[model samples]
Target: MNSVNNTDAAKPAAGLSINKRSRSWWSAPLREVLDLAFPPRCLLCEVIDYSSNSHSGSYCSECAEQLCPLPINRCLCCGAEIGLYSMSENGCTHCRHRNLRFESVTCLGMYEGPIRKAILAAKWSFSAVPIRSLGRLLATERREELQLLKVDRVIPIPQHWRQRVFRHFNPAWIIAEEIASALQVPCDAHLLYRQRQTRAQKRVPVSQRFGNQAEAFSLQDMHVVDGERILLVDDVLTTGATCSEATKLLRQNGARECHVAVLGRVLDSSA
Candidate 1:
């Protein structure tokens, strides 16, 4: 039998290590050059984010401070801001009588100020950057709450084919993907789909919003959702109409539990 050349075998491993170091050595300077050429900007405010501690390269220090996490005084069911003294076991006044299908909700912040502007910019521009940053921020800030839910899958509230074609991107899908990545869960955009094009929830009055989304969504595959704990993602939760309708379908189709994660939660003044 021929003697094996152990030294030759070790040379290849050492060469591989040298190559990796070489690549890493060059990558740092290249990154610095690129960053110098295109300084990072706040994803929301579009201002230079010089702060080294910026959240996910998304917000400037000011914007980050302004976009702080929602206070603990929010309603657990609907994620609406409420006075600390007003919380109850069943739910807050906003969702006490309302028939919300999702088990609970988490939001980065109330929809206003910087958060509102960021969401609006993301929607109008059809840009994924801001929304992606917002999603990552949401995941980072709400990691504990989200992890406690033990969700098996992440799903974005789907858009109608027509609207999707027009928009060129689905904000919900982008947000869902980021959150799913953070949670190490699968993000399935096609498991659920819009059955019909419904009027924009914003266009419809609050009382009519639920009706608008009724029958607007259907499941493409029920087996995937059956007995699975799901985390539904959306850009914003306004009247909770869209999410509610989506959750109802999941629950009806045997989803064991459904939770919601939204970048912003619109505070209902009437509530």
Candidate 2:
């Protein structure tokens, strides 16, 4: 009576292992049946994608081509598209005189065409498909360049709790998670937080954008960021004010380096 029932104790573990194996075995066939029943459609254009490289069945061939990395030259400092002969070593004309806190910026493409439509759809749609697709595409397109940075952590530019409640989802977090998964780094959504509500950067005038973002963010734990190379992610970069403020906070907290990644970069200031 006092002795433990070793054989009985082992039964539970054995049963759990068999259950896991059963689930794994059935998963692929189940997914295949589901796919046949409801063929995958492009998230952006809602067209059935028959191509193999449909980006996990998220985009059709035409939309995929539209979302491919742009061939235009981009400023390393601010991610602005520059003239073929324009200097980009220090900063482009767009950000040369401005105080941009991030070391460098990377983006999938300019904020127009399919990229713009995908981003705009992501905002109002409750479905995670659009944002997740955009995030995965960004990760796939920028894998090599992002890997070179050797990022220690991925952090999304956070939203205020009120905004989060209103929006019901944070696109940045999803994007950061995808990039972090690709980079094999941790995505810490809670590391940085917006401290107060501010006017949308798009709505604010370019001249007042920096002031609008001033003191808008705070960190949860500075110790986690100390000496770490961080990659800050967001859905779009308009004037670079929001990301700059976030990067400034990370650097002030002792982050070794901070890099920015966004799905879209607005080429026109008025956009």
C-alpha RMSD of each candidate structure in angstroms: 8.2, 7.4
TM-score of each: 0.87, 0.86
How would you encode candidate 2's per-residue C-alpha lDDT over 166-217 as one tens digit per residue? 8868899888878987887888998788889999877887888999999999
Model 2 bad stretches (over 4 Å): 1-37, 51-57
Error of 2 at 118 (Å): 1.5
Q: Which residue window of length 10 is worst by lDDT in model 1?
A: 1-10
Residue 138's lDDT within candidate 2 is: 91
Best by lDDT: 2
Model 1 spans > 4 angstroms off: 1-19, 50-57, 269-271
lDDT of each: 0.80, 0.82
Report the Cα lDDT for candidate 2.
Answer: 0.82
Worst lDDT 10-window in candidate 2: 1-10
